[model samples]
Target: MRWPAKLPAGTLNRSIMSAMDVFPTLAEAAGVEIDSPFELNGRSLWKALRDGKREPRKDWLMFASETPIRGHFNVTAFNDEWKLVQEIDQGLLGADVRTHLFQIEPDPNEHNNVAAAHPDVVEEIGEAIHRWRMLYPVSGTRHELVPPPGWRAPKDWAGYPVAVGDLQDEPAPGMPPPFALPTLDWQHGEAGRLIYDCEPYAFLGGGLCK
Candidate 1:
């Protein structure tokens, strides 16, 4: 398959390729030839891509990464002197989640005239959303919600909004200053989900997944 064009920045680098090579090697190192296509979950590979790491292509199935720490954060809690020590235990998860949205866009050529094209793309995107909802059925229901001190919500809790914003743009009204969802490789995952769901002719390989 042609790789997704909109793959995250570090996805194709040599370091990632090398890391990918390790999966098969490790199996050999352990004297076990896992003859099947090396199957890994999508999230794991994506994490490797984000971290400038890679893994051998196994027969990967679509699933989220198990890692608890996958993304970036700012230590704003430290600003309150009394909370400085307490803040050490707090940090965000899934920095990769932040980049999930920018990967897809309405075709520029169809810009004001996308009404004809929007229907199919919208349906496809909606199905992806549904699958994600089915896969992860929990929620925190906010743009940001602070956890009790020394605690954090499940990583997938706040992820849906990010996912939705990535697939479709919907602005909340009367919500202080305007906010834009931080753009990332949203389409890659979205398209991958479509492929997983057996959407016919779905283009999983392109600038979006590469």
Candidate 2:
């Protein structure tokens, strides 16, 4: 990965940008115009590269880092300093469905959960996320996006069924087996069809569906 000698060495921006930016950036570089009604979600880095600035061209950048189809449904909104991680989906225990705020300058690792300390920042960023979602409403049914009970990963062809509960309680191979069979309370009506609900289910503090 050798950078061209003609381009100067410098950090472009601290804000996050998606790979989706490439299309428009290349279009701009080629002197192509985007149709009026069509718009690109990312800004071109050409100007920033030409100027060698650390600041982002836009005041803020918003995008979903993970979608429900992949596994987790989360949206992130960030500016130069603050990053807000909004959990649009809920996990099995509904623990993952909460707002998390971090100061990018100090907490680049995003280990700290400052949503409790700065309620105002949470609300502000939350509203921004809401506005962004409103502008570009997510397509497809919400139910199919939500994960099912005890669904940790995409269903595999291997017949190893994953149980969602106190795994610690599963007895050792040498130990005496339990008398009863394990039961799972899955959504009854949504057997073959996808259920589209943006609500989180917290049955035993597991499950990542929203």
Candidate 3:
């Protein structure tokens, strides 16, 4: 909500809105024209806000990592009732991939993995993700997923910190299995450079690297 003189002031609708909505929404509110051939992925919330409706403005919203195809692909789609998290190349290390489901209302903490109990819901949400990806495919990257040795977090929350000492081997909840550098079998060279063979059908640089 903005405090500007032109904007409305009220408790607006409860909705799962995407960050993508900001561009078009702000444009319309400011009486600016955005001429385009492509259909936008987001809708403006101005109508619901102007009418003072408390209903949801959108049915669902999507969240994903920028380089989903590059490495540790993480994508999530959620509605008012449920959420689905799909992880690929888990931990940005190797090929452990899977999906987990959660009931948003009851499991506020998102601790319990109800996927086993609610296969139908899992299938439904998974289809939604599939459709969305088909419409707007995930992007790619040239750099390797994991960084070289001696790489440290640039910011406070950057790199994943491994547990040490007594708790070193314990698995962190909701996180994929810890990455063992040895498991990757990366061939190390001078100046800390590392290399690995791409899979036979591995997709990279907008095509198969092999």
Local distance difference test scores for all models? 0.30, 0.57, 0.59
The model with the greatest lDDT is 3
Q: What digit string (tens of lDDT, one per residue) describes model 2 on residues 1-210?
A: 124663556545443556867777667766888777866666776555545655353455776655423335778888767899877654445535578899887998999988999999889888888888787654432434444333333244363443333133433343322332112222222221122342445555433244
- The list of candidate 3 runs beyond 4 A from truth reads 3-13, 55-59, 66-71, 90-95, 135-210
- Candidate 3 lDDT over residue span 53-83, tens digit each: 6545345577666541234567888877888
User: Candidate 2's C-alpha lDDT?
Assistant: 0.57
Residue pairs that clash (backbone atoms under 3 angstroms), model 2:
91-207, 91-208, 92-206, 92-207, 93-205, 93-206, 142-196, 143-195, 143-196
Stronger candidate by lDDT (1 vs 2): 2
47-157 in candidate 1: lDDT tens per residue? 444345544443311223221222222121101011110011223441221211111133323224332334554344334544653755323222453322112122254
Residue 34: error of model 2 in Å? 3.3
Q: TM-score of each candidate?
A: 0.22, 0.54, 0.56
